[model samples]
Target chain A: MQKNKLIAGVSAGGLALLSSPAFAQSIDETVNHLFASATGWFVNFIFSPFPGTSFPWIVAWLVVAATVFTFYFTFIQFRAFKHSISLVKGDYSDPNDAGEVSHFQALATALSGTVGLGNIAGVAVAVGIGGPGATFWMILAGLMGMASKFTECTLGVKYRNEYADGTVSGGPMYYLTKGFAERGLPGGRFLAILFSIFCILGALGGGNMFQANQAHQQISGILGDFPGWITGVVFALVVFAVIVGGLKSIAKVTEKVVPFMGVMYVGAAIIILLVNADQIGWAFGQIFAGAFTGLGVAGGMVGALIQGFKRAAFSNEAGVGSAAIAHSAVRTKEPITEGFVSLLEPFIDTVVICTMTALVIIITGQLSIDPATGNYLTEGGRIVTVTGASGVGLTSAAFESAFSWFPYVLAIAVILFAFSTMISWSYYGLKAWTYLFGEGKTTEVVFKVIFCIFVVIGAAANLGPVIDFSDAAIFAMAVVNITGLYCLMPIVKRELTSYLARLESGEIKKFK
Target chain B: MATKYIVACDGSSASGRAIKVAVEQAKLNGASLLLVHVLEWSPYSFLTPEELEERHKRRNEELKRAQLALVDPLVESLSSEGVESSAIIRYGHVSETIADIAEKEGAAQIFVGRTGQSTLTKLIFGSVAASLAQIAPVPCTIVP
Candidate 1:
């Protein structure tokens, strides 16, 4: 009888909270106004100076770094591609090592952090703006970005601090401060502090807000118009439960979630592509033709190249320090193995997954073209995705072309993707927060609460400012991270050279 | 001692209980304790090449951790109790590995705990308790 009463009281409490007015329309508007305007300055400075070119130069450095790393590492992305796959498979993992997760789990976790809305909404946006030719550039960027990932993740592991509790603290902060100090380079401390600050903002913006915003957009598309704050509240509670305990529990959930969702998304894209298999040859032709001629797009080759490279940079996040943190926790004695394992992150996220999304959009006849200009017709506010408007809705329309009910599934998938990414970023942000302010329960709770609040704001607000600020924050992380990568690449090359030589000589035994 | 006993442990409360019962059995019957913790793993779970590669590394780490977290303390206590004891940590199917170790060590008896796995879990993924009854080479004790 008492147990029955306890259940009844809990149900009642839940109903009340669900219907609470405080979690409705009013809160959503307030949140939107607060964040969009506050981050205006950061959006400006990062994108400053056309310098005789119309290009937004902030992304140039990242692309340049990737290109340089690719050459400097002797196209390690190509040569070590098989080795990277093997490392991720745990081919050389030493079970006697200390760490919380396996190679695959670390890769999966980092992938989850990156492989969210970008694959769906971001792809649609890129294709809409850059045209079909963008797909070629995106693939190129993903390919080169593999080297950039190798450079940073190697340092992330090589310089990680293993505490007495057997837990690890790593990323640009550790590598910059310790690695530079060892190399007799100055400014490692300043760079680490700068990277940590950007990482925290990025965790809140790109990781939390951008995900929440896109999820809300998809939810609103399916469920019809509703208060963003309500969606925010539900998302916050779920994210808080996963993230409050930090990496261990978060890793468990993301490892499973990322792989399943990734396969599902890729599988769905493949199935859709197969259904339109007759158009397969024509689609590749359009991509290649569009690459050189730009067909009839306004900006021609330059526009497509910029958009493709930009989206690819955003998608894989090669030089960003966040994945380094996630990868550092894998149970492996050799730091270089984790580096090899991490480069696969971009190849999977962009080259494989994003390409599938692109093919589906093109093959399904969702992207409408302008006959006169030979460019994709843009009306309404959305361009990148199928139908009008960019984001998950556009991706949904492409899938809806194949299966009518897929929009609902896509909505749920988007939410799951967004949720997983948010939690992973929460860890990234939390680590940065802890690094800045010494570790303690009080500091953790404070950061977590702030992060949860942002989820709701992200859902309620206009996508433009939230995405703008997040893109800027994410790129800011790249700026600081790549700077550190530049100083540390020689060491990474030495480690790679030694590991590969030893591997070839049979000194580094493969356990399996 | 003429007799040897095998105890399957996982550092849980129930596993601690299994250890306690095994210690008493060792004291009463003049048997030695061989505490074992098996991290149940199957190569089939690693369907992809990536998972296969990490299998050995994962196995080594699991064994090392199990030895440190489960076997070491249990062995120390048993020895301090005037009961001769040793430990083994391994990665494989828990029931099969436990039984294999028991057979190889020539243990006269085996002990294990009723773990947190529910009735449905045991139904689908057969419990260590049920498997022991069918495959164990010696008499088995399921400590509650």
Candidate 2:
């Protein structure tokens, strides 16, 4: 009887395995179809172009808000640039202050969140599509983004709630609700709720899923083609450990290691540039020429500008109000100091780092620009990706051309970047979750489990419409955040003026 | 004017000897003893935003616990022995902070327990006694 049972179990297992492939394929198709249809309306509405134009209204919304803040603050990004450096260096920090974080710690954590795929893959996408000129617009947008970061972060700290248990919470949600009410403005609560909802969606899609998706792609590129679900399950388990198990040491280790990888990445870029030293001037020339003439890039200069601003906004996230959540945790009596520290984020992320990625791609001949036509080589009316690979893969190809061993390094960096991003976004999403549902152990755990599950789904499925919807959700945050920022600008100006006046009078003591 | 002496405590047997020597010296010289316990910390160490958020609260808790467990009882025992004493707790590089307190307090001399760190540790991260001997503004005494 036992021998008969064993034989029967083995036969059943074999039979199920033989049939499972077709069943699995059908399931995958059904899920993909459902996601595409469900998310189509949101993606269309958010990314819909302006009247008779291809420019996305969401991109325009972010750019306009950044530009307005730059003017409203009297170019505070430039004016307080020196002060921002001082604050980050801890020269003005009071060790006895009630806050938890130093300016540098806050900036570094926020940078880890914003600096991931956007700097690596997103820049590749921009330059690949918009030509070399997108670099120029990207740098410009990054600079203007400083002011927007400064305003939102200042408001974040000013409106943060401190509890008797020695814990605190702050972000765009706090500012929108409390700040609006303080100014006697109606609809602050509604706006806050809307912002929180979008923030959660953005966190799931772009932060968790997109990160897992890209990481799996990079790993499979190296380790040989296997199912994405395998990668997804592994990533999900590790992420679950860090976020749910409270494995803070692992999180801290990643935080330290990610910055080191960032440095190595930049160093490699510098070496590649130096290796092709003679082409440095020509690369800049291409950037400048492409910015205006579009270098035969489709949709001309306007296309370049749109891609540049969109990628930079996506990369630095200056106006999205996410950085405000990170910066609000800083320990300081003066809220304006965090704002100063935050402006450096865009400058470093987009102007410095993203520019490096663009130059490497342009200089290494990955773009394959045709000198005769003054246009990048194209197939089927669209600029072709190297080896039919786009995004981080294209970036890897560019680096591989310089160093044969670089793909392995690139793969490691990509995984590290993806992991760091997921952890940071987990925190951001958790904050949004608690804001909406009210802080509770069970409620928090529910959000985390859902976030981890999405990581697996994000890795397994190729959900184009879903990813688009997620991107739109991130920008939707900018819409609600920037509106609150407009009403709250005067408040930021008041804080900045007072802080600067005190600094000039030597009233703010220098600790070092 | 009464002189002042500094004692570094680590709640070790070596530190007990150091404390006894300092108390004796304080009585003889009519000096007040400032017992200092320094917790090792590096400002350059990076932390996550969540960790950073809880840092100040954690630091305060650590300081409170150190004062109650290490510094206060020692100070009370010294006073009972008719030795004038006070206590301080701080976070930073161990030797450097103790030396800093010595300089700022205008003490004539400093006393410390020879650290019990192993040879490998001492070679890697030098013992506090060795560091204090080199950098202290006042003469440093390391009691075994």
TM-score of chain A of each: 0.91, 0.94
Per-residue accuracy of model 1 over A1-512 as CA lDDT, tens digit each: 53344345435544654789554454555556666667789998887646887577876887899999999988988998898887767677654331236677677667878898888888877777777788988998899999999888889889987765456677889999999999999999999999999999898888988899889888889779887766877888777776564434544554556567778888889998887788999999888887887665557777777778878877788888888887776546678888888999999999998899888888887777766775666444224334565666667888888889888878878888888788778878887888888889999899998898778667777888887888889899999999889998889988888887898899999866
**Clashes (candidate 2):** 1
In order, candidate lDDTs are 0.79, 0.85
lDDT of 2 by residue, B1-144 (tens): 569999998798888999989888888889999888888776656677677667777877888899888888898888889998898887778888898889889999999999688899999989889999999999999887
Candidate 1's C-alpha runs over 4 A off are A1-34, A95-100, A244-255, A371-374, A379-386, B1-34, B40-85, B91-123, B127-144
Cα lDDT over the full model 2: 0.85
B15-97: candidate 1 lDDT, tens digit per residue = 88988898888899998988887776542231111222234455556667777777887788778899998887766678988
Clash pairs of candidate 1?
A89-B50, A89-B54, A90-B53, A90-B54, A91-B53, A95-B60, A95-B61, A124-A384, A125-A384, A382-A389
- State the DockQ, from 0 to 1, for candidate 2: 0.51
